[model samples]
Target: MKASATIAVARCGERDVVIDQRCSAPFSVRQCDGRILLASSAAAPVGGDELELTVDVGAGALVSVGSVAASMVWPGVGGESSSMTTTCAVGDAAHLDLSLEPTISLARSRHRTTTLVRLGSDATCRVLEETVLGRRDEVSGRLDLSLRVERDGRPILHHDERFGPDVPGAWSSVSVGAGRHVVSAVLVGIDPGPPEVCVEADRSAAWLPVAADAAVAMAVGPDRPSTMNMLAALHPALVRTAPVSKPRA
Candidate 1:
């Protein structure tokens, strides 16, 4: 199945409002608590499925986008790979934050995801992404990820990576090592100044400056929590809301 979604936000007086929104099955979008949320209506992006999302932020507007839950990829009947692409446009003086839950690639499944960001003069944005190899005690399937960012038609960053048992060089000591989860973040509005690198027994992280006002941070670890923790320490989000921990029974 194929699904497409679009969202447009514009600044009106003192507040930013959603001017337009279009949703399809398995891709539901809604506004809540002054932000936009993407929710899955059904099991989606199964092998052979294609999904696309587009976002536009009007000049001077400040907006944020997030997902409700993690996405799961399953094998398709024809064994073809599932793919998802996201395109975003930020207008002059506008700001956007795209932070979504992790995506899990199940055993025997194949998936690919790509994100492209275009910014006008003085526009800024923050994007966060997370991925998990597979469920606990199960082998992971093949997965590919790509990210591209441009400001005023000038390239700012272009990165790509592949993972899984089938991908050669992914398991080497110099590659992912014993990592099964990854987290990456990009900040395009502020200058991180310098580069920083950290390595531990189960994880490694790096913060690299890319442009005068942009930087990228990445981390890989044995699990999701460690990876996210590492990236959080390197490139802290402007506004982050952590999940509430349950009390012991």
Candidate 2:
């Protein structure tokens, strides 16, 4: 299923905002917590399900995009799989925050997610992500995640994580989920809150709350040697733009 949402800031006055929005088939939204929740449900198949979601926030706007409920990845029907691709755009000094809830993959169901972000040099954006391998019961299978960041059409950073059956206690390990439902957040732009605040969150992961001259990125999951190295080698500019230094716990 393909779905899109666009918000344009006409004016910002006194903590009030004016927005313009549009959506396509299989994508819908509901109001909650002074924000809008976007959602999509698609037909599942064996190879998997594919959901492409896009959002654009015009200049000088503050917007947040998230789901009303935890996203689900069902087992592929007839040998099919499921995946999602999300793209976001943020303009100058504009704040676009996507506070995503947890994503769960059922037994035998394989899933992947790719996020692409584009932002103006002065734009500020904060992204959040959480993927939980199995819920209360029926645990198994691998979940792959891929992320890419770009600015001015140039690739910045990329990450991929895979978790599942072959892994030992795959979903509960410190390198994987740390026995807790994992959650991740990325904040970028000229002014990204205070340094202390970012450090607190990064302590939850590894490197974080860094500066980005133009862009920033991150990825998490059961480690695959190549994937982690590749994410680190994403681009010198990307790593330099955002200083993500980590002190081993």
Candidate 3:
């Protein structure tokens, strides 16, 4: 199956308003409490499925986006792989906050995700991605993720990562080591001051500046709570108030 969703928000006189919202099967969009919320109406991205979402913010507009629940990737028939792509564009002087819930990779499943962000001059944005290896007591499947950000037609960041039994060096000391959960985030138009690093027996996290007004943070831990805790310590504003809820059916 293939599906796509889109949303566009712009400043309307005195406040930000949704100018366009289109949803397809397995992808639902809603406006609530001054924020745009995304909800999956059906199981999706199973092996052989393709999905995509696009968000647009008009100049001078401020928009916040969140997900209603965590997404679970179920193994596709014959263990085929699936993919999802997210694209975001922020206009000059606009700000976009994308705080979606984590995605869980179930055993035998293979999934890939690509995120691309384009920013106009002076535009600001925050994007976060989190992953749980698998359900409790189960080995994780495979996941490949990539992120790219460009500001004013200039590239500022490009990152790629993969994890799972099939990924080379996924469990090596240079990677997550023995961790099962991972978090990655990027912030533009905000100076997080200086780099911060924290290392512990079972968990580690760091926030590093990548550009004049951009920063990236990464973390890994034995479990979800510990991993998110490490991220929250570095950028409290990016961490959600509540943890990602259990995966939907």
Q: What is the lDDT of candidate 2?
A: 0.55
Whole-model lDDT per candidate: 0.83, 0.55, 0.83
Clashing pairs in 1: none
At residue 151, what lDDT does model 2 achieve? 57
TM-score, structure 2 vs. true = 0.67
lDDT at residue 214 of model 3 (Cα atoms): 91
Report RMSD (Å) for each prediction in the order shown: 5.1, 10.0, 4.5
Q: Arrange candidates by lDDT, highest first: which order?
A: 1, 3, 2
lDDT of 1 by residue, 23-111 (tens): 89899997666567899998988999999999998898887888889999898888899998999999999887888789898988889
Model 3: lDDT equals 0.83
- Per-candidate clash tally: 0, 13, 0
User: How well is each residue in 40-93 modelled by candidate 3, as lDDT tens digits?
Assistant: 988876888799989998898888788888888888988899998999999999
Per-residue lDDT of model 2, residues 171-207, tens digit only: 4433454332444445565443322211122222233
Q: TM-score for every candidate vs. truth?
A: 0.93, 0.67, 0.92
The candidate with the higher TM-score, 1 or 2, is 1
